[model samples]
Target: MTQLTTIVISNVKAADETDLCISIQNMRLLRILSIKVTNEEETLQMDALSSPPPNLQKLLLTRKLEKVPQWFCSLQSLTYLYLHWSRLEEDLLPHIAALPHLGRLKLTNAYVGKQLRFGTGFLKLTVLWICNFPQLDEIIIEKEVMPNLKSLWIDSCMELKIVPMGIEYLQNLQQLDLTSASRELKNRIRNVDILKVQHIPKRYIWK
Candidate 1:
């Protein structure tokens, strides 16, 4: 319905896929949409759904997604995004940075990339949280990316050896949070790399 502003669908079965597709396309005023399929092998074909409304602000997709749907980039008004276990087989940072208004992002075992890079733009992003990504070994942040980013959280990435490089340049950064990281990583940050983010207003680390 045109007046519908929020829709959340979970445990979607194979037979109900068609109906969900139709319902999404008709929700012209939708501002929030969250979908999680119970079957890990089945992907919700987001590309087949109609474009979200210009005012839509929050999107969460959990389950097995091969890649982000292109329409997600067109949601210029999106402010919050969470993708968990999405099965993204490519670098998703570039796609996410295109959201002009995005302020918060959380990714839990969502990306398969060994190296996650953020190049130049996420004008409004303030907080980023990532967890449980076993393959992630490096995070690269180029100069001037996410200019307004204020907080960063990392957890349970056993392969990551250190905090992302170039983090010192985030002038607005206020907090750095680390949890469940490998002991070696904790020691590395505490003993050797503390200077990199020492200027940050707050830091929380739990080994």
Candidate 2:
């Protein structure tokens, strides 16, 4: 187990948190860890894992979390992260933005916030996907943030009124995908924001 590089645990129960943490603590070489809880309403207490695998690169978690775990700040090597059904109501970007090597991030039904603002950091990110955000109405991507981003996908965010603010700053963006987005929002992008995304080589919008 100490040499394990990847572990995927599905249908995890809340009762197994302790033993799971203990097992993870022993996997010093673990690089990929994915855990999907059996009950979406159950929150896994991962803070007990005092020393997380320092070399972890990809983490996918599907569970209910009251807040972003404090331990996430230690994943300096993480490049890809997927969070589903976290249902958090607070600003989550601040906790993970400082990850120097992070390149891809996917959030599906993970937050209930009204706005998501990417002010700085994420210098190496190349792909970002935001989906199923029930209450999200706005996303602000400031200049100099995620400068290397090449693809952006927004899906099922019905309340989002317009394209991300400062999206034109991403001169390197090559693709944009919108699925199940409101028609008005789509029209806004095609009509009012045409100049903002004209540089993007590929744009896919679906009703």
Question: Relative to the unseen true structure, what is the C-alpha lDDT of residue 175 in candidate 1, on a scale of 0 to 100?
Answer: 89
**Maximum-lDDT candidate:** 2
lDDT (Cα atoms) of all candidates against the true structure: 0.84, 0.90
lDDT of 1 by residue, 62-88 (tens): 887856777777888899999988868
Clashes within 3 Å, all models in order: 0, 0
- Whole-model lDDT for model 2 versus the true structure? 0.90
lDDT of 2 by residue, 1-207 (tens): 899999999878778878989999899899999988888768866767788899999999997876787788889999999998888876789988889999999999889888999998999999999999988899999989999999999999999988889999999999999999987789989999999999999999977
TM-score of each: 0.94, 0.96
- Give candidate 2's error at residue 188 in angstroms: 0.7
Off by over 4 Å in 2: none
In model 1, residue pairs whose N, Cα or C atoms come closer than 3 Å (at least 3 residues apart or on different chains), thus clashing, are: none
